[model samples]
Target: MARMPSAERRRQLTEAAIRAMTRDGVPRTTTRSIAAEAGVSLSVFHYCFDSKQELLESVMTTITEHYVAVVRDAIRPRATVRETIRAGLQAYWDHVAAHPGEHMLTYELTQYALRQPGFGHLARRQYELYAEIYEALIEQLAAGMELDPSVKVPVLARYLAAMTDGLTLNFLVAGDAGAAADILDVIADHVADLFRADT
Candidate 1:
């Protein structure tokens, strides 16, 4: 294989780990398997990740970034705040609808982390990343649209994160696309109502 920077090699292995974990539950995915998936030697995998915990954290962060990029692009100041919010939510929902397996793997990772000794912090970090992403998105939207929210940004961010997390899991379990879309609409309207454009 051609030589690559350490960061590039780590990203390659992380993506491979995501594929492996998503296919074979997190508990089942081993560093050897991730190495094989990435077409790299086990030594290289070890060189990149000190432990499974580090790899899992990287995988969770990458998975979140996948959909976050989509939502960020979709939220770019629409004609109205409601339209922008709905676009962002729809973008995220579309990702869940399309990649159910990947999203399911996120929940599995959470459970796997929580149950594993010395790995509980991974689960907390995963949720923290979710809230942090929402907080950044909220700030971005507020700044772009000159809107002030009734609720503080940090609180609203956590609320939105929790709401979106639950809603995604509900759709994953129930498999109701129509109902999910309706709920997204309601959420968009409710969220839009919470913000007022600066006069």
Candidate 2:
């Protein structure tokens, strides 16, 4: 193909890798397959990613960004904190519902990384990334709403991350959109209660 910036090329390859991995399990996806999926030469794939581990990291980060961006935009201050929180959670739930395969792929990636020798760090980093994103989102919501969280930001962030993680998996397994929506309402109410006026 015509020349493109390295960053752009990497993004193209990363998206292709996600498609390949999401379609074929992480264990089955190979760099060569990703190259083909990206419609790029093997050399180009190698030029973009040094190792499969690096590619996996990029894929994980990209996948998280996909949904986090939606939630970020959905979380703009609303009539009430509960509304804002519910909007964000609902945005995330919508993403999970629409892309259940992709969400399932994330869990598969975590398991694949953990079971692979010397790759455990990838799984840990995957989780740490989740908490980090939640922390940033929490801070954003607090600042936007001028609210103070009863729990520390980091603690609250991790709790939210864990709650969503479990809830997403539950939805995937149970395939119950109505039940998931009800749970999101509960989570939004619970999280909103954890905040108060900043003053």
TM-score list, all predictions: 0.96, 0.96
Show the lowest summed lDDT stretch of 10 residues, model 2: 143-152
Model 1: lDDT of residue 118 = 99
> lDDT per prediction?
0.90, 0.91
Clashing residue pair totals per candidate (backbone < 3 A): 0, 0
lDDT of 1 by residue, 1-199 (tens): 8999999999999999888988998878888899999999999999998988888899999999999999999988888889999999999999998899899999999999999999999999999999999989998888645545357878888988988899999988999989988988998998888877776
